[model samples]
Target: GDSVTQTEGLVTLTEGLPVMLNCTYQTIYSNPFLFWYVHYLNESPRLLLKSSTDNKRTEHQGFHATLHKSSSSFHLQKSSAQLSDSALYYCALSDRTGNTRKLIFGLGTTLQVQP
Candidate 1:
């Protein structure tokens, strides 16, 4: 079965520091779309970035990630951390196996930024 894995459970950082959330995945299918979804305190989870092209960088909401099929990774990175950047982040892969494409998500990562 296909699965997504986020090695880091929690990341704590001070304002102005850089941040990285590790993400990796495994799948049996060849064509799959990887996504980064951010969930704030009250707002519903929303797609931050997504890409299926290997080695292409995708950016959204001040964050950027490049999917590397060779490494099976799509690590999210930000140049500087902001207090408002604290949130729950999830890495997901869409399995286009059948007529229905299912999204498999990694264990969520919580980012806490302090001023």
Candidate 2:
């Protein structure tokens, strides 16, 4: 079985500080698309970054995450954090091992950015 893991439960950061959210995954398939989904206060969870290319970085909304197949990691990072960056981030893995694509999501991480 495939699974995604987010070790951090809550992440707090101040404005202008860098941000990092730990993420790791395991899968039975050789290639899998890893994704970062952001969920704001009331907004629907939307895909922020996604990539299947190992060692390549994917970025969106001022955030970036690189998928490292060798280490089985895709940690999300931001150079600087903003007040608007406060939200819940979910690390997800998607692969088509059967007839449909199955997505395994990690436990959500709550990020609070203080001014």
Q: What would the per-residue lDDT of candidate 2 be over residues 1-115, giving only the tens digit for each residue?
A: 8899995788999999999999999998788888999999888999989975788888888999999999999999999999999999999998846667778999989999999
Cα deviation of 39 in candidate 1 (Å)?
Answer: 0.7
Predicted structure 2: lDDT: 0.90
Determine the C-alpha RMSD for candidate 2 after optimal superposition of all C-alphas: 1.4
lDDT of 1 by residue, 1-115 (tens): 8999995688999999998999999998787889999999899999999985889999887899999989899999999999999999999998656877688999899999999
> For residue 95, what is the lDDT in candidate 1?
63
Each candidate structure's count of clashing pairs: 0, 0
lDDT of each: 0.91, 0.90
Estimate the TM-score of every prediction.
0.93, 0.93
> 109, model 1: CA deviation in Å?
0.2
Clashing pairs in 2: none
